[model samples]
Each structure stands twice: as C-alpha cells, then as structure tokens.
Target: MGEVGLRTVRDGQRVLRFQAAVIGAATSQRGSSPRWSELVVYRMVDGHYLISKIGRSTVAHQPTCLRVNHRMVPWSKAAAFGEDSVQRVPCPDCRPELGHGIAPDTMLEVTRYRAILCQTAESAAESLMGDRAALLMPQIVQTVLAQCSESDPNFSRYAEADTALPRAWENTTRTP
Candidate 1:
C-alpha cells in the first residue's frame, strides 16, 4: 500500500535492517526500489527463536502480529539502540517456538559443548587443508561459530575466549 522503502526492527538489544522491497515487484520496473510486503521479519542471528516484525516506519517489534515474512538475515549489522530508543517487545509468533524450558545448568553445559565443537571443527579444517586453510578458514570458522552460538546469549564472551592462545601444554613438550 504505501510507497516501499527500507525497514528496521528491534530484536532484543539489536536493531536489524533489511530491504522492504521484495525480490520481484513492479516498483523495480519503474527503476525504483523493489516492494516487499509492508511487513518484514527480523530474526536473531544467534539462531534463537527470537524474531520481530517491522512495518514501513517503526522501531519496535509488533508483538501481536500473527504472521511475518519468511526471509531472514543471518545476523544484524545495525548497532544496538541506545537506552533512549524504544524497548523491543517479544513477538507472539516466535514465543511458542522457544526451546522447552531447560534447567540453567544444563543450558550452560550445552553452550560450553557448542564452543568446544566449534574449536574442534577449526582444528580439523586447519589440519586437512594445511597451508591453504588460512585462505578460507576464517570465514568457515566464523560462520560455524556463529551458528553454534545461536542459543548462547553470551556469545560475545565465548567468541573472545575462542581466540585466546592455546594452553602451554599444547605448545610445549617434555624432554626425557
């Protein structure tokens, strides 16, 4: 209905921006930006069930909406909004999709396991690819690591730890 333009939605603390224009629309023929549904979905990059719906011009998620666009951006490039910005409301469409209420300790263990899994994958890729690994390993590792940390709300901390130097024992050997 309204003139199509870019859209933004707040997902938790982050602001996500995506093309309001659909992939194929009459607007494109006119040499203007494409036109997607007035509604757009914004999903959390960490693979969490959290998502948001934004209209032509708004910042907060529309919690009551029963449907949203299927297109998803893996992660958001927009910085988190400041305290002055509107707080995000949880979307009803995605709330039911949250994981079964698991115990906190179990969830912690799961996150740790995922971090280790990422580390192992990196090691394996480096070993198999050898010299050529460096060329693509960063991208591979980062994508895997981001996916693995999907459920982890504290992913930034884990990401920092992942780059830490290997243990002393890993780099040293004892002489007989």
Candidate 2:
C-alpha cells in the first residue's frame, strides 16, 4: 500500500479511542459502502494523524485532520455545538469516477449515502435472511459510521454531516 498521507495528532489518545469506535462500526457494516474495506490509517511525519481511503476503485480516499476544543469535545462535536474548530481541506485529486455514462459534473447528494447503505443491506437481507428487515437495522448504519470513525477520527464528525459520497466522486474541471 502507498503511504496514504500524514495524520497530525493534537491529542493522540483521544483520537485513537475514536478511531477504534469507527473501525468497529465499519467492520459491522462492511456491506454499507464498497469503499469502506479499503480504508487505512497513517501517522504523518509532522505528527498529525490521517485516515486515507486506499483502493484501486474509483472511490476517493482523502485525508482529514482531527482536533479538539476546550470543552474536551472533538472538533466535529464542537462544530455541532457552535464552537470554532479546525478544518481539513478535501484532497485536490480525490474525486469519484462515475462510470456508464454519468455526467462529469453531476454531484452526489448526502442522502445517496443512506440510499446506498440501505440498498446494500436490503440486498444482503434478501439473499441471506429471506426478508428485507435487515435493511432497516440500525446496526448496519452504525457499523459504517464505526468503520469511518476508525479510518479517521474526524470522519464521523466531519464528512458524515456535510460531505456527500457522490459529490466526493465528481470529476474536477480544473486542470492540475
């Protein structure tokens, strides 16, 4: 695997704990996102922590940084509470490659993540359990979140709210 990137640590211990939670969630819901299985963690030369998506598929694996505020709340949580928080810029090259004639500029909405998760769960349920009930299970979503959490401590906190999986895949119009 390539050196995904660097992860800076403002508080390593807390970030590690959150990382575990993310991993657990991802493992439990492997079927949620095809990209989930390819996630990895790396510590940067600068001492920052990075969670990278590393796979041969079109899915994007961008690095995000983690930080905490005075109340001991994670940056994501702090954002929810209306506190100023550190931010990570999206990877300039990380864009989804839509296949089968999808327009280049089409943006994937946030809800698509939920739809994809639900579809995957429903397919699994239908094939294995003989019922679609598994589609509605909270455990699956939790697993995805957990995996995301583990891959990047800030993943669940940051991207979960604002980033859309499909948008992340859109082809950038700018020339590098």
Candidate 3:
C-alpha cells in the first residue's frame, strides 16, 4: 500500500491531507505496477515538480525512478489551464531497466502513456483546446510504439499484449 499527501498553501496558510492505495507486484506477462506507498515528493520548486517512485517487482527487486512534470495555469480560456504544461522531463534512474526490458521499462512506458493522456485531458478541458486532444493521442501512441520498437525487436508481435494503451484505458475504466 502507498500513501499520498497533498499540501496547498495560499497566502501563507498551509493545509495537508493524506490518502492511501494498495499496490501489488508486477506480473511476468506485462510489467510491474508502481508501489503506491513508495512515492515521495522530492521537491516542488518553481513550476516544476519532481517525484521519486519505486518499481513494483523485478530481478533488481526495487529500483528508484525519478519523474518531472510541468505545471502552469493558462490565462487563455481556449487553452487547457490546469493540465501539465511541459513534456515529462526524462528519467535517468530507469535507463538500465529500459535497456534490459525489465519491469522498469513497462512502468516507464505506462508513465509516458499517462503523461500523454493527461496532456490530452488538459487540452480537452478547454472549449477551443479540445481539437488538439485528437491530434495528441495518436502522436503519443506512435511515440510509445517507436520507443518500444527501437528498444525491443519483438515489440510489434507483442503490441496487443504488452503495450496496448487503448485496452489499458478500457480496462481501467471498466466497473468492477
């Protein structure tokens, strides 16, 4: 299980809240899920946010990863205001796992996929920006495929199984 803490301060006043979620080990068929409790806020400086995350399960047991996401509030109503404003900053810790096709690779891919999705969601939140969302999804999917293709020759054969974001979205949205 993992816990999340959110703190917001306006005009020098601070408020904090915590939430928890359960996480499980990675399966051989796909990749490992993130350890929710392992998330730590390394820093939140300027408009950039950084986080340290732990991988679920792999031969390495636990490998720490870093993520950088952008934040900005757009003034234009046509632009998505709350969505992250920048492409995810590159993560250095998972390079070895990315190279070796370990559990880290899967998590990295999923993270990238979500970044793209969140970008789309941000765009969709605006009336005029919604059109941009259609353009972004395919581009993100293609990028994901290209990255996988470059890293693993077997990527295409396993595309439907290993990294189908569409199915992942569907499965995630399905009601239990």
Candidate 4:
C-alpha cells in the first residue's frame, strides 16, 4: 500500500488510511430511512461545505462550519428563518451563501467522494453478501454511508480510488 501512496495525511492532521475508512461497518442503523440532507444535498463526505476561497470573513456555512467544525445546521433548517437570514451569515473563509447549492468545484469533489463510497460498498457487499445482495442493497449502503459521512469526515476520505481501493480488478481505469 505504501508503494503507491495508499496511506496519507488528510486535513493536514488526521492520518487517513484506506483500510480504516472503507472496511468498517456502515455508520447508521441498518434499514433506517435516509435523511433529507443525505438525499437532496451534495456535501463533503464530512458533511461540511468545502470552503475553497483563501480570504474574507462572514459567510454562512450550512451543514456546519468547516473552520470551527461547529455543529452543522442543515440548509433547510437555516432557510426556515428566510433567505435573508441564510445570506447574512458568511463563513470566515469560503463566504458561502447559506441555502445556496454547493459550489461547482465542491460538487465535483462530493461526487468523487460519493462514487468512491458506492464502489467500495458494492465491492464489500459482493465479497461478503453475494452478488445478488450487491445488486439489491445499494440504497441501503448509500443511506448508511451518507449517515456516516455526516458525522465523520474521515469516512468521506475514501474519495481516492488508488488509495482507498487498490485491487487491480476493482480499478476499471487501470491498464494492464
């Protein structure tokens, strides 16, 4: 794994090992319904908005503030106060307009993370639960993994294929 850089530091702090991120049990109770945020919004695996801008203060961060790791307030929940309130609280860095959809770059990143989660779950289900289960169980897997990401950003770091799932058979993009 080390030969290909499968283990690395994430967030400049947490040591993110692929084995630790993808091999664990799903984070939610089996068979629970998906939350609204999990179903409708695209968010970082950690459920925080990716604040990409380097400067500026005062912006709203929905689903939680990345700077402070504050408790996340879902966009819908905050929008309940009206859009004006939503637009008023700017993040110190990203300057997100609360209730707005994710920034495009962030969407791409979130999509990558979601794809990794799906691929890993499918492989795991096939290995442990059989192919039929793999076919039938993706929604459950999505729900559980989404739940996990909401609470633990580390769970989201399975975003990189080379590091997260290194099997030759699993990597469709690799050449022989």
**Global Cα RMSD, each model:** 19.4, 20.8, 19.2, 17.5
Q: Provide the TM-score for each candidate, comma-separated.
A: 0.17, 0.18, 0.16, 0.19
Candidate 4 structure quality by residue, lDDT tens digits, 1-176: 01122322232223334322222223322342212112111123332222111111223443334554433334444443232232244454565553456442220001001212223333432332233323344453444444444544544633322233345456567656
Which 10 successive residues of model 1 have the least lDDT summed?
107-116
**Please, what are the lDDT tens digits per residue for candidate 3 over residues 1-176?**
22333433211122222231111111122323332222222112221222222222121211333331122111232123221222222234544333332332222222110111112211212211223333353332333333333433433432332233334366478676
Give the Cα-based TM-score of candidate 3 against the true structure.
Answer: 0.16
Better of 2 and 3 by TM-score: 2
lDDT agreement with native, every candidate: 0.28, 0.30, 0.27, 0.32
Give me the displacement of residue 27 in model 2, in angstroms. 6.7
User: Residue 136, candidate 3: how far off, in angstroms?
Assistant: 9.7
> Candidate 2's residue-wise lDDT over 1-176, tens digit each?
12433332222223222221112222222533432223333333433333422221112222221221122333233334332222222223554333343333322211011111112322322222222233343443434444544454444442242221223235455556
Clashing pairs in 1: 22-35, 22-36, 46-150
User: How far does residue 10 in candidate 2 sit from its true spot (Å)?
Assistant: 25
Best by lDDT: 4
**Using lDDT as the measure, what is the rank order of every candidate, best first?**
4, 2, 1, 3
Candidate 4 regions with alpha-carbon error over 4 angstroms: 1-136, 158-173
lDDT of 4 at 62: 34
